[model samples]
Target chain A: MDRRDFIRTAAGTGAVLAARPGAFVRDLYAFQETANLSHVEARYYIKLPDREIECQLCPRKCRLGDKERGYCGVRENDGGTYYTLVYGKACARNIDPVEKKPFFHVLPGTAALSIASAGCNVNCKFCQNWEISQVRAEQVTAYDFPPRDVAAAAEANRCPSIAYTYSEPTVFYEYMFDTAVEARRRNIRSLVVTGGLINPEPLEALTKVVDAIKIDLKAFTQAFYKDYVRGDLAPVLEAIKLVARQKIWLEIVYLVIPTLNDEPEEVRKMARWILKEVGPGVPLHFTRFTPMYLIKNLPPTPLSTLRSLRKIALDEGLQYVYTGNIPGDEGENTWCPTCRTLLIRRNGFAVEENAIKGGACPSCRNPVPGIWA
Target chain B: MTESLVVIVRGRGVRSRGGEIAPAVLARIYERGLGLLTGQTGAEEALRTLFAPSDKVGIKINAIAGRELTSPPAVTLPFAGLFSRIGIADRNVVIWDRTNRELRAAGYALNADGPGPRILGTDTAGVGYDAEPFVHRNIASRISAVLTDRVTASVSFAILKDHGLAGVTAGMKNYFGAIHNPNKYHDDHCDPFVAELFDAPPVRTRHRLTVLDALVVQCHRGPAFHAAWAAPAESLIFGTDPVAVDAAGWRLVERLRKEKGLPTLAEEGRPPLYLQTAERLGLGRAAEADIRLLEDEV
Candidate 1:
């Protein structure tokens, strides 16, 4: 009981078991006290010549040396100056539900705030957050929460967005690019999430300050990104064609995993390579694999394999295909590829009804592409 | 299929005009390299043929290159004082690594139980890492609860360098500091994730010996500490075939990078192909006709 009094008695017994209602409360103050961490100075790296450096922000350009550390153990190179020890050091904040970052066309049943920090340039043996993405910002227990206090804790938790998310926000890319330029100076919205390994000039400068990135992809063979995602499906299909030629909002997910990446011709060649590279209104999802970390003897995914891989990414035309983690399955909803009309419904990460009036499909007004208001 | 002996030794003046380390010529070069890697002429009968005075041991080391290339407290407290000369207890011999601020930035002196042998780290206080993750093939991690629940005989003791990515970070990549992700096995060049993390079962069922600390051999842009390819090489390699003491510390860091002309971790492409994938996973003998080597000096 001395890691700062076990994180101040597990953050005062997680604020008195987060106000008691079902009370099993265990964020044991998200553990941290691994000597506080955060060293800062990191950004697309370089410095080489003896004390060594390299990093160029992902695609594993690592190169480090003087006290090395970059297969994203939250960056470090120290004597040659690379740094980023989980910059604003959050480790795992919360709020959730931008459809549980199943963005399902962003801003649906909003909330976000998410956060995260440790590390992860891809080690995904089904890492449902490998205790903070396969660890090493001194093996977790963070909480400084910088970047303008993560945009003032997403405007004091009324949170219109600000996710960066559960772990691999591109190895805390300078604390998610300065908490997406301080949650875009107040009107919130920053999203991100990631696994699209990165580095196309820092993911084209994080698609000019985040807003909706997502990208899990996780398997469309390079032999399942070299046997179970140590990483490299061509830099996550060039970070989903650099976040669909940026102006933000791009989704993806995948998960599947039953006999490792639930094949069906690798989900119809990853839905015909995300319908010929990030097109066909990119929403995707599929999601369902439940066997936690290092993939516990495969079992969870099979609600008819996420409805036969969401009918092969919606019969390979891919107009926003869905189906994640099975919650009352009508493949989770969001229809009207042109008047099929359910236009956003969802149940698990709860949205329950949207209807899409102006962003279109109010019974066939047609348009539907994202950030719906 | 038989070979694997190794040994090396050297020691000579064992460094002193202030560079320090001469704990009696590094304890007669770790008692003549554990009496020639255990043929036994008494370094406490070659550590009672690898410990059993109610075992416990540990020693681990390689303090992440801090005080000019780590593993120093006069070379790992005279090899943790040969495990209290075999009856193992100055509190059951610990030593460790993976922070006590890198064993107090390599000069050491932390001693968890207020005694002689315990020099702490695995982050100390209720020692860390190992709340699961032991996995193996393509190695999942979390080890270092001081090598899975405080030693039952281990040793590694690393520090022979030139690694700019495992072409030569000796003694089986020094058990990548006994787990907790050695930067996710420095990809490919740390091949077979440093021989599947020394054939994992927490360092292959509690290792036994290996030693290395090739006295200041950084040999060129190494696991950091450059000082002009830092080469004193007062040696000390030994082995219990942890891939023939890191393939004789990668042929003494390619003979001090071919005496400075450099270029040959396979002509600079990062050649510790995890010692032929730790000898195709049998976990020993990385070529040179399967290692018999030996040497000496002290």
Candidate 2:
């Protein structure tokens, strides 16, 4: 077809032409604006001979030649110098509820300045936000929200914390690290909502500046990680261990897909592992998974599955296991583990009530582990 | 049955030391490759057979490696010019890659909407990656607007080079540039990912030809430019089957490595397993017995 005819047809068939189920290419597509990606020299990388460089930031350890990009697609080796293409390049910016970040333990009802850039190290098959995470820096429309500017925007918008969310924060490590440092200076807290797919050194460094981290532990088995997430499960487990060891408030979320990862045995094993590794006090959220991306063949997770997984975690002696994405469910509320009283009554992205004084349950006077100010 | 006959034409003087392809030699290389592949004596006759008059051709080149190692504009533009000569309009032929920056860095002027076969990248204002991903077997990525919207038929005018992960980056792997997330598939020696990405509809459906510019091959430690490892072996690989074209490119790189006493890709632990997977998927044959390689001195 001719260019004019193609555009006319594309425009004419705009809403009717849906991407057929399991089809690889599309008839109608929308090209995003060019994201103004940065090229600043990156940290946590070593220069090698003949302009080659090795990235030590993540486990991938991408050994790149001059002009080649890493697995993250944001970092490139520029004539023996490694540079990050997403330093302070905020591809997405929004003011979301801290509860939306799902930090129920921390400041419950406050707003968080959430931001992220394009690109992720791992490709999750059930990615709800693949438009941002699964694309290169240049494929999105981005703004120049520098570290200092991010802090300023958060403060200006009355957000208590700056959240490195939407996409994987690990991919935009430099931006997150710098932004966290700047937030610390302004007395604003830093929270990272991630899959915990990170190396130790970077995680250690990130924890030093951030107040809390919510790790989305996808499944219990390495097989699930390989088949579904295209990433290793061990590094994520290691990240959780490191955060738990660092005295950081850590929470784990498991999106219960229908048949793929919602097995009771898997949930039980995961609960036991969490109980052993991070202790019984850590909150574990069994989130309901929606059918999206490559895994659209299955339906959304059933309420029964979420409830069953939650029950397993509670039975495993895990103190604070909850179900998410189900509005107004009792699992959305944070009941005091010791006293069995609602500590933080939550519905959707709002905190309805808080029966806590001095960061402890009012009924039992048990100190709850959170950043409640 | 749709018979896809691929050809590889080797030329002696395609590369000049000043980093420009001698256009005369390049035109001859194209003629020889197309003639043998299409069984037509002339370049126009071969291209006319391959492309319908209504087909708007897109020549996608790999230009991320800069001028030292990229599909030179001299080689690709002349081929785009050939499409026009064979009754395809100049406005209909697009010489494109992922971004205009890489094209400019590799010494090509960026011209998307203007005249003369429209040279540009996917990152142009009206042109960018598709908002939704083209979800294929193992690959899910946002493709370039040029491919999804503008072009009717596509040619992979890619540079042949050694990749740290993929073993060799040639015509088949060149479609990585057509997507937004090529970097994500570089793991596991680019096994399954490379083949899967090509099997994706955006690439496989539109892809009509594969042409590798082997004038300056990055023999070792590449997909990036390392002067010490780069070879001056003046050759170009052409084919209709993307699988066979890349396989020929791999053989050329292996030949260069053996001459340099360097370790083979297997010894280095980065073989292009994607070709084998592609073969299994019935895209094309990756085996040596399946390929009919035609070499010429031009």
Candidate 3:
């Protein structure tokens, strides 16, 4: 059988998939069926002698031999030149609501033309999209969506912004950067959804193009990053700092697993850090964790756990703290910090109402920080 | 504890500058190596000692480097022919690798049906990785169905080369192709991960032998083929002990590198620590004192 047929058969038997969390059970996305990989030469790599290259894309700095791929599985060192096999080769694409990216602060109530290629820099144990993120470029079926075509598709679909999402966009830096550049030429905004595991130079360059960036800050502790995420927390923290310094919109999402990262002390520490470093205006989302991929043993984060964490962040003097993955919760809506009026009411990925006018609270005229234009 | 036995069989003109491998010379090398490895008087007897007549044998070959540096068809096909001579059906024997494209580039005819030896790849239609991951230490990866489902016994028929990270790629490192996420295990010079992966049930329980293709060894800057560094070793190395065979292969690469006036892999800070890791796991011998070397001429 072909890959498509094999997946279908496996799905019918409930043999291929791990136990998914509740939110994923309600929304099952279909896998694409065309493994059209690209061989475009990558950016942000250092060519070494003897046909080896050091990838400077993420913190891994993977020094690869000729014909060897990096940890990301999408980039390879071919005869001393590093190339991204997923460049402009999108494996997942859809017009998702802007809040699904959890960018409540940017372009609320608008549709985002979201796209992702196969592979990610970090291997998160609880990865929801492991079928795409954990495979090589050739393993997944992908489409050849070039930068110009991506920009055109976003414009044609009436999406106000293009989101580089679903999988980590850092591994597809060249594709995302060029696509953002093309989108800018058409007066369309570009956004990024990432794990923030990129190097400073590339992250700095990317901020100049993308209008907003939603960083999934998995956890605060280095142990959590090393064990669960297979990445370093310092670089992500550094990336958050760098993005906040720029004019681009920045938001952080921390997935609170039940027993892993939901401790009150750690949550308070993270909230205080955000308050000090990134300021209180930046939206901090406490998204619920799901049982997926390698970490299938853990249960979903409890609502009380999420609510308590949100209370701690708000109590720590953060402005726009929100809870995610819980439909019809009051925390899903954005309440103005000054007047306590709901600026944007959201349920799941759908927006019920948006009350902000000219980037300020409609009730008290308090200057709420966002890209509302 | 007995020393692990490794046989090195050589042919004077096994490889030509025109990229042609002498099939007759390769056949002799395979015969001698298998005879010594199994303590058998003949090739067919050696095969009988290693596998049952009802067993489906999978000869997993390394073809990631394409035609330039891979397990040559000239060498592997003759080896498969020996299994057929031992009363194992040709349909029960599979000569396979990771992808069909790599197998085709390595000059293998893609044969899955109406087959003699069932030459194909893991990516062939109706064949893919196992649905669930085989979670070994530091590795959660999907294994190719050819190894997990199709084969009862496995032979790692690998091309020996100087790896930029692992210091040497031989029998043990060749199994990296069997997993879906080898890219994740390359860090720390592939130490412990390679050994740990081999210790996983799918590979450890079924593995029967290791055959190293040393005819055209890439001694420097490989896993990839570089003409200046590629040396025609004109030999095949065989053993039941995966670590000992790879340890022996490392010596060959170091010898070639020394001849070219380059630093040893140890001096370059990239020794194949996985061999020692494998030894610690009680998988096989890695040290010279624990390995018995035997040489023969074809």
Best of the candidates, TM-score: 3
Which residue pairs collide in model 3, if any? A1-B126, A34-A142
- Give lDDT tens digits, candidate 2, residues A1-373: 3334433433433222233422322211223324476889998999998788999888888998777888877888888999999998876777778888788888888988888887888889998777667766766556677999889878877789989988899989999999999999999999999998888998999899999999999988899999999889999999999999986788888998988898899889889999999999898898888888778899888888888889889998999888999999988888888879888888889888988789999989998888887
Where does the lowest 10-residue lDDT sum fall in candidate 3 chain B? B124-133
Query: Mind giving the per-residue lDDT tens digits that candidate 1 earns over B1-298?
Result: 6788988889877985356877888888878888888888858899898889898888887888787778678778777877777787788888887778777776877888887888877766566776667887878887777777878878888888888877788777788887777888887777888888888777888898878887778887878787888888888888888987888788888888898888888888878787887788787778898789989897
DockQ per candidate, 2 decimals: 0.14, 0.33, 0.38
Backbone Cα, N, C clashes tallied per candidate? 3, 1, 2
The candidate scoring highest on lDDT is 3
Per-residue alpha-carbon lDDT of candidate 1 for residues A39-127, written as tens digits (9 for 90 to 100) = 87888888978879898887778888888888878788878999888788775666668888789887798878677777788787877
Report the CA-based lDDT of candidate 2 relative to the real structure.
Answer: 0.83
True contacts kept of each: 0.36, 0.42, 0.36
lDDT per residue for candidate 3 within B81-148, as digits (tens), equals 88878778999999998888889889998789866889887777667777667788887888888998
Badly placed stretches (over 4 Å) of model 2 are A1-34, B1-10
How are the candidates ranked when ordered by TM-score, highest leading? 3, 2, 1
Interface RMSD of 2: 5.6
Q: Estimate each model's TM-score.
A: 0.38, 0.92, 0.94
Model 1, residue A140: what's the lDDT? 58
lDDT of 2 at A252: 84
